[model samples]
Target: MSSPKVQLRLNGIRKSFPGKEAATQVLDGLTFDIHERDFVSIIGPSGCGKTTVFNIIAGLVDPDDGVMLYRGQEVESLRGRVGYMMQKDLLFPWRTVLDNVLLGLETKGIDPKRALDTAREYLSTFGLSGFENSYPKMLSGGMRQRVALIRTLVLDPDILLLDEPFSALDYQTRLYLEGILMEAVETFHKTVILVTHDIDEAVALSKRVVVLSQRPARVKAVHDIALNEHSPIAARSDPRFSGYFHTLCAELDIQTRKSA
Candidate 1:
């Protein structure tokens, strides 16, 4: 049998930003890869440059040194190949829900009527059919995030970079969306790289977890998640789940903190 194809690769990525005194290095020669149709979660300490990695992959920020390859060729930018979603919904207040979701296809020179039709179909699928005419402010936090996701998914990019996209939502909503996200990935065959702080969320949504170190973040470990139950909520009951969670917390220094 043949091995899975590599969808993306980050080689020797180095990045830094101006600090109060001098440049503060965020990523120091970090390297990683994402296989096709994978759901990979990235976990690390705060300020460890996890978002920086997402930015580089999404073409929002350039690294000082590194090579990013989509497929076999070096990618100049991920403008069309990647879709990015952040913690904040960042939806337009003026645009209606359907109009907002159509933003991606519209930018790609797709026909206006066609984009609207496609966006409508997605809205219907995601249970926002009746809310298409509603504005961003009218929707709940969870609803807004769903719209944001639909906007990204409408473009049907090869990969998706989700940066704590569910962090701001309530626990129940977060869990609900995690299941939906998994279903979306499965149905769309999307290769996703998610940056998140929640260990359980990572374990629930990702097939593999990439753990990064402190400042100048580098890969510390990668764990393949093998859950006894398939669903995110059901996976919690799996005896092995807590072990994976504990191992991750240990790596991220979560378990070592002394009591105040």
Candidate 2:
């Protein structure tokens, strides 16, 4: 009955990087809003500055122009309030699964006993219970990714910035992980902004999908995915899924052809 509250807002965000000839504009007047508990996926042609958007949101890089607001208050960057997970799991090989998950909390100086308990509870819930002592080298790709997700989630950030986190996994593993990610979002009440190249993945996981134009990227379109199911697999089975997927494909195709 009530409107969803805006958790994050990007207003006319612009960014450029120095190139040999001149500055290369990556994002130009990109703007969007993420609501609380919203799973929003961003898709665009390759090199469309999707990752640049994420970096700005994560405080890893600053934008050349525009403003970011959190909960109606203007802010420069969401460094402490956001959790970022990239395409690579980025797990330390020598550390055990539990240790890797505990890394963030340790860095924040959280009490060791409390942090261990929290990490173990998440591992158990995510079905990584028995692999606590297993090293990253000992785990499968999916398991390592699970550990990576746990590592990000344990920090308890208000928003999650996922930069194609499941892009490298097999289809089956990606589906399973999508389910886990959906569950985590619901359980933790997180707001998520995902940058992905996969249209199907975006349709299955996002409440809304934001499409961007090619380099010096700007918001091209935003589609609300109206699926009756939440789980990725079940979302695919929805009769509306094909329509959304094809529509998104067409948008990207048009962008690609124009760029070419």
lDDT string, candidate 2, 1-260, tens digits = 69888989999999999999999999999999999889999999999999999899989999999999999999999987788999999998989999999999999899999999999999998889989998999998998888999999999998999999999999999999999999999888988999998998999999999999999899999999989887999999999998898889889884423443
Q: What is the C-alpha lDDT of each candidate?
A: 0.89, 0.92
Clashes counted in candidate 1 amount to 0
- Candidate 1 — worst ten consecutive residues by lDDT sum? 251-260
Error of 1 at 141 (Å): 0.7
Worst 10 residues of 2 by lDDT: 251-260
Q: For candidate 2, what is the lDDT? A: 0.92
lDDT of 1 by residue, 1-260 (tens): 69778888889999999989999999998888899898899999999999999888877888999899888899856877788999999998999998899888988999998888899999999999999999999999999999999998989999999999999999999988888888888889898999999998898778889999998888889898888564778888789888888888888878644656
What TM-score against the true fold does each predicted structure earn?
0.95, 0.95
lDDT measured at residue 10 in model 1 versus the true structure, 0 to 100: 89
